[model samples]
Target: MPGSITGTIVDPTGATVAGARVRISHRDQSAEQEALSGDDGQYSLPNVTPGPFQLTITLVGFTTQASSGILRSGENYTVPQIAMPLATAVTEVRVVPSRVEVAEDQIKAQEKQRVLGVVPNFYVSYDHHAVPLAPKQKFELAWKTTVDPVSFGVTGAIAGIQQAQNDFSGYGQGAQGYGKRFGASYANFLASTYIGGAILPSLLKQDPRYFYKGAGSKRSRVLYAIANSVICKGDNGHWQANYSSILGSLAAGGISNLYYPAKNRDGAELTFENTLIGISESAAVNLLQEFFIRKLTRNIPNYEPVSP
Candidate 1:
C-alpha cells in the first residue's frame, strides 16, 4: 500500500536546514526517490509505497544522516525532526576526516564486517575512496584481527591439517606436535598481519585494506584485483608500489626459518619464491573480495560514492 513520509531537517544547533537533499529508498525493493527540503526545512514524501524504508539526508558541510523504519499501509509516518551533524571540517573540494575521528568511525564499521556472519573479513573496504587510517588505527586493526576467536580457530585448523599430513615433521606427532604447529601457524599470521597489514603500511603511508571495486567492467575489475597485489593506495590517495605487502611477505617467510624444520626452511631463493606465492594468493583473495565476499558479509554500511 502507498504511504507518506514527512520530516523537518535541522542542523546540530537546531536551526532549520533548507535545500538539503533527502533520498528515500525502499529496503526490499530497488526503488529510490529524492526531494529537497523547503525554506521552512519541511519536506514531504507522499505516495511512497509502504514497506521497510530508509531515509538519508545530505547537505554541504554536514555528516550524512540515515534513518530507517517500517511504513504501514496507507499510513502517514512522521519521523522525528532530523538533525544532521556537522562534519569535523570541510573544504571547497570535499570533506576531510576530523583528525582521527572519521577514520575511527570508518574503522569501527569495517570491523563489523564478517563473511557469512561469522568469519572475520575486516581487511577489505567496501568504500573505494575510503579515508586513510591513522597510525594508531592501523595497529588497532592488526590487534583486533589477531585476537579474534575465528582467527585462532583457523590457526588451530591449519595446525590440525599439518599434524594429519605430517607436513612439518620436525614438530613430530600427537598432542605436543599439534601444539607446536599451532603456535607456529599463529606466529606466521601475527607477523604477516602486523608487518604487511599494519607496521609497514603505517610507515610507508599506504592503505593495507583491499578497496572494493564495485563498478566498471569485469575485465577492468579483474585487472584491478591482480594489480592490487603489487600496487597500493597511499595515504595521499595516490597509487604507488606496494612495498608493504611485498616486503612483509618476504619478512614473514624469512622469520619462519627460525622455527620451521631445517628441511622446510628455504634458502634465499625459496624465500623469494614463497613470497611470490603469497602475493599470488593475495590476488586470488582480492578477486574474491571484488566479486563475491561482499554479498556474504553482514553489517556492511550502505556506502555511497565520494568524490576522489
Candidate 2:
C-alpha cells in the first residue's frame, strides 16, 4: 500500500524556511523521493510505499536535519516541524599601518623627546625596529633641530665663551665680535646638521637616528655604541660603514674655512682633524645615550626593547 508524507520546515527563530530541500527514502525501495518546501514552508510526498522512512531537510546557510518514522498502509503521515540552526562561520580580519605612516608616527614621538625636558633628543629611536624615514622626513628632522630655541641658546653660549677666551682673535672682542662668533657658530651647526643628518642620509638611503639597544651585556652595549660612529643601519636594515656622517663632517669642516680667520683655518689638515674630533664626539655621545641619556630624556615612548 502507498502512503503520503508531509512536513514543514522552519529556522531556529521559528520562522518558516521556504525553498528548503526535503527528501524521503525507504530501505526497501531503491528510488528516493524529493520535494522542495513551497512559499508556505510546506512539502508533501504522495504515494510513497508504506514502510519505515527517513526524512532529510537542507537549506543554504543552515545545518542539515533528519527525522525518521513508520507510515501505516494508505496513511497520510505528517512530520513534526523541523528547525534548522544556522551554520557556523569564522572570519578573521587584520589591519596594518603603512610603512610611511608608521614612520611618521614614530617621528612625532621622537620630536617630543627632550633631554631633561629641555634639549632636543630627536636623533635617537627607542624602537629598534623602526621604519626608515623618507627624504622629506629627514629634512624635516634636521630643520627642527636647527630652529629649536635650545639649539640657539647653546650656540649663543658657545659664542659667549669664544668671545671670553678670544679664541678666534681675528674677529676681535666687542658686541660686533660676539655677533660674528654667534653667526659663525650657528652656521656650523646648520651646515653640519643638514649635510649629515638630512642631505647625505637622504642621498645614501641611510638612517640617521641612533637605535637604542637596551638589552645586552654592558661590554657589548659599549662596543655597539662606539662602533656606531663608524657604522650605521642602512635603509635596508643592514649594518654598513657610515659614509654620510664621515663625509658630512669633512664637508662641514671644509666649508668653515671660507668664514674662519685665515690663521685659524688649516686647510685639509684642519678639516681632517675636525672630522676625527667629530667622530670621537659622536662615540662619546653614543656612550652617554646608551648608558645615561635615556634615563634623563623626557617624553620617550615606551617601546619594546630589542632582543640581545
Candidate 3:
C-alpha cells in the first residue's frame, strides 16, 4: 500500500521556484506522478498509496536531484526542504588581429631610419604590398631627402672628391671652382629626385618607390629587382614602363648643361647619351639595393614568411 507525499523547493535566497518539475516513483510494479511547484514552491502527489518511493526534481541549466524513502500505508509524507545550487556559468571570448595593418605600421616606423641618421631612406618597402603612398607622400619623401643635412654633407664631400681627382677640370680650381661644382651637383640631385620621385610620379600615375621581392631563388629575385629599375609599379598597382625615371634622368642631364663649363657642354646628342648613362647608373644602384642594402640597414623588422 502507498500514501501521499508533498514538498516545496526553493533557492538559497528563499524565492519560490515555480514550474519546477517533480517526479514520484516506486520500484517494480510502481506508479509515477509529476507536478509543478505553485507560487509557494509547494507541490503534491495526490492519492498515492503508501510504499517505498523515489522523488526527483529537474530544471534547465540546473543539476538534477533524486532521493528514496519509505512510506507506510495510509500515511502522509512530508519531504524535507529541497534546495538546488545555482548552475555554474561558462563564458567564452574570441579575438582577431590584423597582420597586414601591423606590417604597415612597422614600415612606417622603419621609414624614419636614415643612412648615418640623417639622409632620408623612405623608398624601400620592407613588406610586400606595402600600401601605395599618396602623391603628397611621394613629394614629402623627396622633399625631406633633398633638404636633409646629410644630403648637403654628402654633396660637399663629392665636390671635394671631384676637385681632388680633377674630374671636372672645366670648372677650374680654387674656392670659386669648388663652389660651382658643389652647386651643380646639388642642383642635379634636386632636379632628378623631385622630378623622378615626386613630380613626374604624381603626374604619370607611377609609384617611385622600390618594391623589394625578398623571396624566390637568388637569381630570380635578383632579376626581378633589377628589372624594376626599368619597369615600375604604377599608381594603378600594375607593372609598367618606368617613364618617370627615364624622363627624369633626361631632364636632369639637360639641365646640367646650364651650369657645367661651356667647354664641357654636351650638345643635344651628348645630353641624350648622358641620360642613358644615368639609367644604367640607376640599374647598378637598384642591384645593390636588392643584394646588399638590407644587410646594412639597421632598423628593418626581422623577415618572417607570410602564412598561406
Candidate 4:
C-alpha cells in the first residue's frame, strides 16, 4: 500500500527552517523518495510504499539531521520535527594521498619490525596480500637496509672476524687493513642488496618481500619456503619466475670483480656458483621467516592465516 510522510525542519531556537531537502529511504528496497520543505518548513512525501523508512534532512548553513519511522498502508505519518543546527565550519583538509604514500606507510610499519627487538627483519611481509610497492619504494627499502646503524655494526663485526682469521691477506694488517676489509664488506653488502632487492625487482616488476606462510603442514611449508627462492609474486599479483632474485645475485657477483681482490673476484663459473649459494641462502632465510622469524619479530601486523 502507498502512504505519505510529512515533517518540519526547525532550528534550536524553534524557528522553522524552510527549503531543507528531505530524503525518505525505504530500508528494505534501498529505494528513496525526496522532497523539500516549503516556506513554512513543511515537507510531504506522498505515494511512498509501505515500509520502514529513514529520513535525511539537509540545508545550506545547517548541520544535517536524520529521522526514522514506519508507515502503514494508506497512512499519513507525521515524523518528529527535524532540527538543523548551525553548520559546522569544518575545514576538511581532504588530502587524497598517492599510492606511494600508502606504500610508504606500509614500509614504515615494516621498518619497525625487528627480531628479538634487535635485528631488522624488514623484507618479509606478514601481509600475504600486501600492496605491491612502487619502484622508488623498493629502492628506499634497500637504501634503508644498507644504511641502518645495525647494518654498519654487523659489517664491522664481520670485518673484525675476518681480520682475526687472517682472511684477505691482500689488505694486510693493522687499522688500515681493518678499514679496507670493512670497505670491501660494505661494498659487497651494498651491491647485493640494491642489485637483488631493489634494482632488479623494480625492473622486473616483482615484489622483493618474502610473503610469510604460517598456516600449513610442516612439509608443505618447507616446500613453499624452498620454492620461494626461485618463484615470486609479480606486481600483477601472479606467482612467476623470480628473475629478479636469481639474476640480481649473478649481477652482484659480477660487480664484485670491480672491487674485490684479484683472488676474491668471482669469474664466470664462480659467479654462477655464488648465485646458487645466494638462492640457497634465500631458501634458508625464508624457512626461518616461515617458522621462527615472526615469533621473534616485533610489530608484525595481525595477518589472517593462509595455507601454502
Per-residue alpha-carbon lDDT of candidate 1 for residues 167-198, written as tens digits (9 for 90 to 100): 98988998999999999999999999999999
Question: What stretches of model 2 exceed 4 Å from their correct place?
Answer: 1-96
Best by lDDT: 2
The TM-score values for the models, in the order shown, are 0.69, 0.69, 0.62, 0.69
Per-residue lDDT for 80 in model 1?
90
Pairs that collide in candidate 3 are 1-50, 2-49, 2-50, 3-49, 3-50
Task: Assess the local accuracy of residue 55 in candidate 3 as a C-alpha lDDT between 0 and 100.
Answer: 81
- Poorest 10 consecutive residues of model 2 by lDDT? 90-99
- In the predicted model 4, the residue pairs found to clash are none
The ten-residue window of minimal lDDT in model 4 covers 91-100
User: lDDT for model 4, on a 0 to 1 scale?
Assistant: 0.84
Our tally of clashes for model 1 stands at 0
Candidate 1's error at 58, in angstroms? 21
| Candidate 2 lDDT by residue in tens digits, 1-308 | 57899988988889888999988875434479899998888999999876557787878898878888767657799999999889777432334355677789989999999999999999999877676898999999999999999999999999999999998899988999999899999999999999999999999999999999877789999999999999998887778999999999998888988998877776798689879999999999999999999999999998755632
- Tens digit per residue, CA lDDT, model 4, 10-47: 89898998899999775334468899999899999989
Question: Over 4 Å off in model 4, which ranges?
Answer: 1-98
Clashing residue pairs in all predictions, respectively, total: 0, 0, 5, 0
Model 3 lDDT per residue over 1-308, tens place:
34678888887687878778999875423457888888898988888845456788877755566666656545688999887556667432323223334434644665776645555567776554444566777787788778878789999999999899986789889998899899999999999999998999999988788776666677887777678878888765568999999999888888888888888777889878877777777778777777777666656655432210
Ranking by lDDT: 2, 1, 4, 3
Provide the lDDT at 290 for model 4. 89
Give the winner by lDDT: 2 or 3.
2
Local distance difference test scores for all models: 0.86, 0.87, 0.74, 0.84
